[model samples]
Structures are given as C-alpha cells and as structure tokens.
Target chain A: DVKVTQSSRYLVKRTGEKVFLECVQDMDHENMFWYRQDPGLGLRLIYFSYDVKMKEKGDIPEGYSVSREKKERFSLILESASTNQTSMYLCATDPGDSRYEQYFGPGTRLTVT
Target chain B: AQSVTQPDIHITVSEGASLELRCNYSYGATPYLFWYVQSPGQGLQLLLKYFSGDTLVQGIKGFEAEFKRSQSSFNLRKPSVHWSDAAEYFCAVRGYQKVTFGTGTKLQVIP
Candidate 1:
C-alpha cells in the first residue's frame, strides 16, 4: 500500500517563530502538494510541486512556501508563525499517469500561540 | 475557471438510514469532478471521481455519486448510513494545473 508520512502529528509554536512541516511519500509519486484545512473554508492548497526543485503557488499561497528537495520528500515552511496560521496541514501526492487520484498524508496539526 | 459548491453545510441522519449529499459545479466544459472525505484532524481522502464515460460512479465504503450535466450536480448517495461514515465531505473540480475544493459538508450520525 502507498504510505504518505508526516513528520509531526502535533506541533505548537510561538508567534514569529519559524516552523517546518515535513512530508514523505513512499509511492515514488511525481507530484506533491501542501494544503491547510480549516473549519468552514475546507482544504485550501498552499503549494504544489510536480518535480524535485520545481514548485508552484496554489490558491492560498500567501504567507506560506514549500520545498521539494527530493522526489519522495516535500516540506512546507512557515516563515513567521502567527495565531491565524494555526491549522491542520495536509500533504498529498499524485502519480504521474492517467490515474489522477491523490493519496494524502495523515496531516499535521499546528497551533501558534 | 472551474469551481465547486457544496450547498449543505451540515446534515444529520440516523444510522442505517439512506444518505445523499449534493454537489454542484461551474465550468465551461465537462471537467473532472471528485468527492473526498475528511475525518477530524485527518487529511482528506478521495471517495470517488468522475472523469468520463459513465455518469454514475461507485466509490469506497459503499458510497456512490451520479453526475447530472443538466442540473450541474454530482450528488453522493448510500443505501444505508453507518456511524463511521460521519465526516466532512468535499466536492472538487480540477482545473488547469490545480483543483478547487468546496467549503465542505459536515455529517452527523444520530442513534
């Protein structure tokens, strides 16, 4: 079975602190994505990478950035954490083929105090 | 631009009852449609998707959705609801290089 692992299941950070959320997929997929899930807004894409070292901004890219150093690993970076930025973050990957289904990680819950 | 709408914000049903969740889309042409479920503090899981060919698509966990072009709706249905099926459901439409998800509908399972 394909597994997408998130480094941290729960995290708490102070305001103005830098934070990193790591995601690794064992499926050898080519596409990776980062999204922030909120109560009423649902899952809003923050960024996505189709290949290593190539990233694209998504609908809610503001105040967030991502890095894909290796094909299996993707990282989401919060330059300065704030209370408003606290939310459940999700990682996903899509195989490079006609199967457009995206597999998701367990998710990281971040709380900024 | 392609967009998705889940009109129902919340719905409650007793266990073993029938279920239906509505989804609407706005697109110039036929677009890729999808339904996903998210449990509390978990990532969204793909329930089903409609690309082409058949209008009615069966998905995991005994869930199915039918695409209606005339009404611009893709409604999810299940013959019997389970308590474990209570979760937030989202509808999405894939556009150029990205996909937009609806706000989501929260399901409550009553005894």
Candidate 2:
C-alpha cells in the first residue's frame, strides 16, 4: 500500500510566525507535491520536487517554499505565516516512472490567528 | 493555460438511483483525464483515469466514466449509488507540467 503521512492534522499559529509542514512517503516515489485546498479554488499546487534538492514552483508558490533534502521526506515552509495562508494543505506522491497517478495524504488544516 | 470545469457544484441522488457528474476541459493536445473522490477531512482517492484507448473506464466502488473527445467531456456515472458514495468528486486534466483540477462537485446520496 502507498502511504503518505503528514506531520500534523491541525495546526494553529499566530501571524508572522514561521510554520513548517512535513510529509513522508513510504512508496519511495521520486515526485512529491504540496497543494493547498480552498473552498472554491480547489487544489492549487504550491510546489513539487522531482528529485532530492530539486524543487519547482506551482500555481501558488508566493507565500511558501519547499525542501526535499531526502527522497522520502518533503517539507513545506511558510516564511512568515499570514491569515490569508490559512487553509488545508495536502501532500502527494507520484511514482515518476510514467505511472501518472498521485497518492495523497490525509491533509493538514492550518489556522493563522 | 489549460483548465477543467465541473458544471454542477452539487448533486443529490437517492440510493439505488443512477448518477452522473459532468466534467469538461480545455486542453491543447490529447488530454489525460482523472476522476478522484475525497471524503471529508481525507485525501483525494483516484476513482479512474483515461489516458488513451477505450472511452469507457471502470473504477473502484462500481463507478465508471466515459471519455468523449468531441465534447471535451469525461463524465462519471454509477448505475446505483450507495449512501457511502456521498463525497466530493474532482475532475482533473494533465496540462503543461501539472494537473489542473475543477472546483469539484459535492455528491449527496439520500436514503
């Protein structure tokens, strides 16, 4: 079974605080992705990594950055959290071997107060 | 940029009734389409995908989708919907380097 785990299910942070969301995939997939799900906007990709230490920005990467030092672990960083950044964050993994299917984690709901 | 659209925001169907959810997309070339279901507070689960070949694709939980190239639509259908089938359904299309998803359609199955 392909399992993707996230660091937190729910998080609360004050404005201007730095927050980090961690994700780990057990399937050893080469491609990892971070997306934010909003009410009407659907899932907007924040960033994705094709390989270790290589990351690419997605549709909405303005307030976030990503790190993938190791193959199994990918981290999403909020340089300075803001109220507008509060949303449900999801992490996903693709086999990168032409499978074209992505497995997703439960998701992390972040609240900026 | 390429995009996807789910015409209906929500659809309610009785248990054992047939259901169909509409999805349309605008892609330059041959499109890779996918249908995913997400339960509340959970991640998205792949229902089915259409890359090429057959137009009708069968998926898990007795769900199926038909791809129509002329209409630019891939609509999901189920002969009999169960109460547990209530969830959010998202249609996606692979465009450029990433996959673009629709706003999603919330399915409500009534007993």
* Candidate 2, B56-106: lDDT as tens digits: 999999999999999999999999999999999999998645778899999
DockQ of each: 0.64, 0.62
Q: Which stretches of candidate 2 lie over 4 Å from their true place?
A: A97-99
Each prediction's whole-model lDDT (CA) = 0.90, 0.93
Clash pairs, candidate 1, are none
For candidate 1, the TM-score of chain A alone versus the native chain A is 0.96
Chain B TM-scores of the candidates? 0.97, 0.98
Docking class of 1: medium
Q: Give candidate 2's TM-score.
A: 0.97
Residue pairs clashing, model 2: none
Most accurate candidate by DockQ: 1
Give the clash total for candidate 2.
0
